[model samples]
Target: MSRRLRLLFTALALAALLWLLFAAAERALALAQRFLALPEWLQWTLGSVLLVFAAAGLSVLWWLLRPRRRRRPLPVPDRSSLEQRIGQLRERGADTGALAAELGELDRRRVSARVYVALFGEISTGKSSLIRALAPHAQVASDARGGTTREVGHYDGAFPDGRTLVLADVPGSREAGGEAHETLACEEALRAHAVIYLCAGDLNRSQADELRWLADFGKPLLLVLNKADQWTAVERDKLLARLTQQSRGIASAVLAISAGGSERYQRQLADGSTESVERQRKPAIEPLLQALDRLTAPGAEGLENRRENAVLAGLHQRTGTLEARTRAEEAERIVRKYARRAIVGALAAVAPGSDLVIQGVLATGLTRALAELYGVKVSDVQIEDFVQQAKLTLRTGSSIVLAVAGNALKAFPGLGTLGGGVLHAFAYALIFDSMGRALAASLAERQSLDQDDASARLKELLADAGGTRLRQLAALTIDAVRDRVD
Candidate 1:
């Protein structure tokens, strides 16, 4: 050890020894005086009893006062796996492209410097005042005007224990839409280690949508209802309840505070010099700061997990919406094309087996196309294998049962394979439609498939399209095929 560190340790050791001796001396002297006040023999007996009691008391005290073990944080998903998933998404032009990029950038920044926590909300929501109180050195205009700040402002602040952070106040949402600053707010949010979203009044539908966008970013967040100083207690509770209801599934740390009304603050004088003055300052700044400290503290599990989970959630939500639209627009076209191929294959066949050939060709082609849409690069063999799996599922499951029962040809045994073309064609369309829907859902959810589960999944896909929905989809697909035939 270095000389200074050695000497410091030595001094602490000596001080601790002396302090312990002093405490022992004080306790012993008091015991001695009380014991001495008794009869000589009684004094000795009582002294022994007192010593035992003291020892037991000390043991119990130690047990009660010892530091508790903290609960372990929930395990974070593998970052490499997450990154690879996101990379595939980027390749497919998923809706979460920007968030994936931002998270990538955030990981880089975490190793580069101090945490950057930003305050953002719509205008007149006390973002500026909060900044001024938290970082006196930072010059933020806090005259309580709507949309006063026109750009991002930076400030510096330190935790009580000396860790430092960059406090940022972004231009409120009022300026967020203008051509010049369209990306400014988002850029700031993307760079932040955590965000404090300030708001006032009841959140309209649009504002709630904006809140989802913020939540979707997956950063550590605090949603603050600013201007609490101006509100009555009842009014405040009502607003909180309303906002809490509206902001469901977003950040749950919603709070109310008045940064300007409850505290003293700094103001720029006429000549440009800043003056310190105290105001109502009731913005609950301390609670917010405490929350921020916990959130930005180094190696915090909740903070890290929340950030990553938020990104994953946004990824899931966006992918579902995009894949739904994409499938609706394109799956129909693919199905139509494959339906035509199935009809031709069946038309060229001999009786009693022509329908089986049509189903095999249709299932194979649709499987290949759907896999390709989901970013799976499959060869001819793989497509054929998947179709066989589906056929195995078809043979064992309810589809054949439904097919035979619903087939009017069963009543005309002599014409078993001669006159049921429409029913057969509609059944083919229904099977393709169900499989395509299941494949799209699986892809959107990023489910990793194993060949072991293929049979079960195929069965599920086939069985999920119960009678009514099947009939509906089958009717539409049949009409489209008939149009092509005509």
Candidate 2:
């Protein structure tokens, strides 16, 4: 386009803008005049109504557009209670060594009286590079490949104010088949007095979740975008703004830096031949340095309580997971034991019936055992009531149970040749297995026996005749009958 055409377009846009402004001004003037001409009382009433509506509109807009804050206070269990739970797990033969070690380390760190800050992020986010920038004298390794930092390495670092700290360079998260390494990084993060979460670009879903997880621990946190030298000034400003908005209340601050990672280039020698050269990019990390100085002003001593709580909170979650797994394994064992016993009892029956008749003694024992295993208190009356409820559920589903057993007998030809009473024995196994599983599941979820819930689950289990389950029950029946004859 010629200069005249560009000039004409610019003028048209300016004129349109000016016309809009003038129109708005004229409308405001007319409204003001009309308001002045109204009766004083009417003017005051209309003015009040307009003010209220304007205020309401602003409030709605603010609510919709405000930056979200997602920081949640960490819930740390009582120290004594947590210790006792770990001890109980140890006695129950669950591995509790790691949980106990976390407590010991928490105390050990408190005694050291030194601040610790962990560099945390996904693989290739320049954590190792940042470590080299902050602790220049340290021998930190950097690689283009992900998962280069496999273990936690510590180095002495200093703030601009001359205060010293221990900076932990941990393995980056989200590497292929690197769950253990990721776990190690997370544990070290919780152990530190504060954390610097590094990223080279925008936050993905997993990174966002990781930040929120750290925020839940209530530790001092800074989210840093590394390798800022790669972005133009305008692009960097826009990226930082988005990150700042993304991290709002979760991070104490969000800043950008170039961690001075190595770059490779070709250089011409005096002989006019080109050669490959590698050199570290000059780091731009003043913003990060200032953020660290402000965040760590409290020192380790002042930050001990939060650090301890964070460690203990992490341990609590780990211990609870272990405890649940151990209990589920134990519950399965108990269920299988009772099922085998029921199969043997049915084989010994003088008159094996078409319907399942749950052995009352075994049913009561199963109920009490599972209840005790789950730490639920139950009186004899409650135990009796649960047993009766199981009997009622079995009665309702007895035909379905026997039909499933008969099909199993057909599926497992060897069981059919075992004898006539094998059908009854297999039916008994199905009844007891279903009952035990249903009760255990109810107890696990409800933490207390809900008769209706257990019964409903029991009904479902009785009608379930999966091929694998039938095969297992058939094997159990054959073993029990053969053992009885022997």
Candidate 3:
């Protein structure tokens, strides 16, 4: 019997003994009262002895019948497996295409080649006009009103040597909202190969924010004081000096530009007469380009190679990690479900004999044995497990009876109560032994199922990861593995 059932039977036996003692004491007291001959001291002594015996019996029963305290299951650590899975995922992601795309973008831009340009300052700083001047094809939506360009506009252009330049325009930098747009524009400029900061001949709070944002990009930048036509030469020069000094630590170059008269200004002869009015003067942009050329020259080759490898590595790692985690979770779920089903089957096998008191003992023993053997601690076993356990128990019980028939008949002399009791106990022992064996087999089956489920989940996970990695590689590289192969 299981420990719990054994304790329960002990309790019932003690209770029956207690009842018998109480009845005998009451009868002795009645007999003493009727006789009136026995000494009061003798009768009292007899009652006290009986009471003491009852108490001792009760105490012994309590010790024997007290419930067994079950210990908590130990936590199983599977860290080695987990770490191995992580390492595999990292290796896979290293060869995927997402990493390649990221690297490719970085390579094209070149790490040190960057520019920051912000279109800002005053109600009509001609920020849009400045962008148009730099890249004629860059379309910035504009009108006569101040708020015509509420959003930031960004454009990129390539020079003859494949070096790229980015430009950004913010419509008006004076208003609070306009200042925010200018800041965004400045940020975009900062991320470029170099920076071109646009401003009217004057400075404002919004213009200051734009400049501050530009400083954050930390790249080479040029400051363009636009609309220089609005100020006289001396006044413009004085303001330009002050602005230049304010931006001394930041700007690589600072120049004055007349957005309206830029074409004519470039063609001025010594007599102050325009010779070639059609040619545009790009005073600020030329210096900005020169700075970018110097920065990108040193690490061009190394940067290209690293960018390509990093992109592939990143994609491969992500795909593998996702697949591994998914498979692990799936394996855990499948194993849990399989265990539950096995337990349910066990419970169903023993349900028919549930009405018999001894059946409860058998059920309890069989359940405990199954739990121990299978490493399952469920509250109840499945009906199927119970049915299988019962069949084995019955078969073993019959075999034992047959084997001991001659000895049993010889001891009893004939079929009687004593013989029947002996046979029942022997059969119970045999049945318990059979149940133990059946539980062991069931547990083995469960473990096999768990292993199989884990293997299947792992395969599915790897397949998915491989497929995703293949697709991404195909998208980003010239020599990727084919989809069919993946």
Estimate, for each residue in 177-214, the C-alpha lDDT of model 2 and write its tens digit.
88998999999999999999999999999999999899
Instruction: Please identify which of the two predictions, 2 or 3, would achieve the higher TM-score against the true structure.
Output: 2
What's the residue-level lDDT of 166 in candidate 2?
94
Ten-residue stretch with the least lDDT total in model 1: 68-77
lDDT of 1 by residue, 313-369 (tens): 444554456556665556656765675565455444567776787788677767777
Report lDDT (Cα) of residue 86, candidate 3: 50
**Most accurate candidate by lDDT:** 2
lDDT score for residue 471 of model 2: 82
lDDT of 3 at 92: 42
Best by TM-score: 2
- Tens digits of per-residue lDDT, candidate 3, 1-486, equal 899999999999999999999999999899867756767887788878989999999999999877544222222224344345455545644333432343345445665454423454555656666666666788778654653567666776555577665655655555555657644443334334444566766666656655654454344456777777668989988988988766766666677775542343356688887665575454345543454456445434433343333333333344445654544444333333333332223233445543244445444654554454344654444533554445544544455434443243344333324434333333333233334333444444464223233233322322232333323222322111122125
Please provide TM-scores, in order, for all candidate models, with all chains considered together. 0.43, 0.85, 0.32
Candidate 2 lands at a TM-score of 0.85
Q: Local error of candidate 3 at 90, Å?
A: 21
